[model samples]
Target: MSDEPMDAATPAGAEAAGLAPADRPIFFIHTPKTGGNTVISHFLAFLPVEQVFPPPPQLTLLDGDFATARERLPGLRFLHGHVRVTLTGLLPLERLRLVTFVRHPVRLVASHYLYFRHMPELPMHQAAKALGIADFLRRYPSYGTNPQTRYLTLALGLRRPGVHQEVSEQALAALEHFDFVGVTERMQDSLTALSEHYALPNFPPARLNEGKASRDEVEATEAVLRRDEFLMRLGADFLLRREAEERLEKWFATRRAAQARGALLQGLKGAAAMPWVAARAGDAALSFLEGWHPQGWVGEPRDGAQYWWTEDRARIVLASASGRGLRIGMHVVETLGFDPARIRVILGNRLLKTETAPAEPGAEVSFRIDAATFARHRRTAVIELAGPRSATFAELDPATADHRLRSFAVRRFTIEPLED
Candidate 1:
């Protein structure tokens, strides 16, 4: 809320806890659909060819023992790939710096759905096309529930059907040791943070694998109304994602501040003048704040690319791309965890518009914030959305195990500068 980065006093992991740093070979898990390919490619470009395990094109992981990979690619210090979370037993954890990235449960599933439907090489494409959203969600738990948890914990890799506390704890414990656990949404920031922390090269990464120009992902998803059904299974995943986000936010924020300080100090020595350094830092901070606009009421968007849960009092900040006034627009979707209720929308706590819609699956609810609100801020504005009540899975379906607070879903939220 306060634009200030997280407090540096609290420790994020073992490194912060003052444990001896284990400068072991790096082991990165390229979880599917989390933009790991871009990361992998960048690492391949920067890392010494012989130091890259199995090399590019054959990226993500190796086929055999660590010893075999070591023999094949001598001097290799980093092992990465589309790997499993249960590598604790397979590798020397004490001697390896582990890292991975995760996306929001909903986005991750959607990306997989879109990506899988296009690739004919994958045998499941036809079946996925036929399964649609609901059937695909029901038939494959991954589309619905704690899918990433399976890859995070080892027990699930045993082909088991249920979640285990011990296994979850073990997996979390393993994560505690990772030098970095990045979120896909904040990838640029995450990479910069990683580079600063590890002294690795930092550069812009290319966006990877958009997918075949076949059926539209959104159309296919909407064709079968599974938003509510899909979220029902995301209870565990949402919790997991929240935890990961809180931790990463602190990690990235802290590193970002540190980098700013380091840059300023370096600038004082002729990297640039003090005023130039200050301007650069201010510009960076402004860009970061602009990115948080149109977020879910409760917190920032999960991946900065999609959806925010509603809050009794939510604020949407806006900054015009051209420093001109904006014609703000917002479209809200019925979350359908419970019956919908009337919601009040406010612009900068000055102007107000309201709407009420039933809490049915795929419910369309929307309102606009008057462009006149922008008159107060020249080129920036903060819009607020408030709901009479929060929704929960238990309230929607008595059998649902989730009790966490939630609100409506948002299909689209945006603001465009008013043209002359």
Candidate 2:
């Protein structure tokens, strides 16, 4: 909730415990389509790139000789992958802080199906496209089965068992032992708890790689996923307990504060200074908040023009102008194979404007955000750009290695105060 940055050198409550978050190696088991991309991306931002094993674009160490790689990479602090828990035995379990997230089985499977269908790179894409939901579930038991339960069951090095009426005791016990197991349904609370438990930065949640499947399509598969359904409840209950513990700890700390009156006075002073603070903050340039690549520039800059690609739905945050509206100009280099790239600009929940970029390269478009809309959002305006479609370079060309789904090549963006 606090926009203030967290200090990496001094993780709260870590010194007294004798082990800081950085001291212990963390293993993040990223289960697919359960907000894992958002979770992993935020965590990765806090750690040294080299220290994170099998880094981005490379999902798991299991793809290679993990043992050899581990021995060579002595500075490894974080290990993340779409890996089963059993593979984690390859690492030093005593020194590892295990983490994962689980979603409701029905939703998880449905999402997974839809994601595969959308992405051409996935092995399941062809199958998902060719077969109906029922046929796909019937044929691909590996996915339709209790994947979460199976993955957790691997914690005990147990072979993945068939779907049952209830979850296995060993699997349930393994789930209980994880350092932090979040629930996707309650992601905000889960992320808050994760930040508190791990002494990590509380990055606002970013929704990525999301897709929807019809209820009828997803519901039919639930009968085969009963074990995971059971495991999901346990995961949710576990998160609830952790949230309760965090609340109690905060309450105790609040009660013990001897400077309550001083704190109140300080808060009042801060409140009084907010107007000046907002004025100063209002001059900041727009920021890419979500659905954009961290690496803003790709390839060489041409003619003093640096371009950034936007995902299908990208969000940009800008500070509100004082008593005036903002005039925004954007240069679009590429459209979605369309003569005119249809762009929907949204302010908060309201559709502010719809504009189109010409097929011609470096097509420039301009729009205005009225002052009243900015005022409605207090001091900040979050603008969402919904593009027509997204495709990867590989999708366009077979030889290219880039697999990121991108749309709208934005050469440049300019924001200025509109004169009344």
Candidate 3:
């Protein structure tokens, strides 16, 4: 018996796989000041203007009449907006393809500040013109802290805009859902990639709403947008990694698997699985694959002992599943400011344990993983340690030159098998 669709609505991303475009329409989440106008111009060349939502003149409207818009949604082939990510809730997500562009937080905030100051009709123009960029950021963190991050995470139902100064696990996981995420600094290359992914004509780029700011102004603005900066770095890294997956078939399969895993993790909340890579040759000890700053240090074994430190969250992947229960232990040696610290241990998204670290070294924190837990997560056990406090050496002692924010340090890590 043959197994082919007899007239069913096409599956999402079917267009990318060479099926009909009408079934899987594109929804561009136009993050403001990220060269979105230029992208819209590119889309116009192929997608008819009549089939686009809230066309050119109204491009920046964040809240349009979505109630009436749904009546027109079926006929629309493309949609772009300066809107919240929650729009996905009202639309047919199963048939929609999501895309967005992000800029370096420094340039994005600078341009956003300058644009607000120059546009007299804007609500914040007077305030922007009245104060320096630093004052403006402090005065309006809601608008300045991480607007792009807020836009991307609006669907999460966060309490307020820019509420998080540090990137959270939920935010990073949220971004993975997008079909495409472009970086504004690499505008042309990103557009070309987008064009190929969607099988659309690649048109020459256009520049719109462009602006410039002094290095001082940009640096002052960038300091406050740490979350967005971290988010952009992750996106850039993903772009570089995506470039390495050259085979179209393999790339699609890999992404689909990741999407499936993410969905399962979300539904199960305490379950996990990712193809684990061996971190070291022996000793049954392993390093982390996620939930840490790109800058981390593994000190050389001194007197046959080694340690790890992170400026932010730290996680470790343990040995492959042995179908037996296990015990995991980590000894804390240093705290952010030579002060006692409280930390939480998380497995998948569930809280496994919490402990208070002594100011002195050699405080061991441990957790028990059952055989069923090992079987559920498959090849490895990924455990994360999170603390509420962080401080830099320079902040603690004026004499020091090291300025990177420091969390806690682990002097030793051990895993012990438990009787089944």
lDDT scores in order: 0.55, 0.61, 0.61
Residue 335 of model 2 has an lDDT of 67
Question: Lowest lDDT 10-mer window, candidate 3?
Answer: 275-284
Rank the models by TM-score, top first.
Answer: 1, 3, 2
lDDT, residue 348, candidate 3:
75
lDDT (10s digit) by residue, model 1, range 1-420: 466543221124334445455344666767787878777765765888777775766754544655565455336667777764455455544445667776787777776776667777887788677776677766776555566666655421343336323234433543554567777787877777667667788867855545454456655664454467666665555666666788777676545544444444444345554422101211120112111223443356455345555534444444432344433334455544453445555654454644445432244454443345444454344455566677565777779876655555555544443445
Q: Write the per-residue lDDT of candidate 3 for residues 152-213, one digit (tens) a residue.
A: 66742443333444544434544555677676777777777788788889978755555655
Global lDDT of model 2: 0.61
For model 2, the superposed segments whose C-alpha errors exceed 4 Å read 1-22, 63-65, 72-74, 164-166, 212-420
Q: What lDDT tens digits, residue by residue, belong to model 2 across residues 220-260?
A: 54554455443444443244334534544443343323133
TM-score of 3: 0.48
Q: lDDT (0-100) at residue 121 of candidate 3?
A: 94
lDDT of 1 at 300: 60
Off by over 4 Å in 1: 1-22, 60-65, 70-74, 155-174, 213-215, 219-226, 256-420
Give the clash count for each candidate: 3, 0, 0
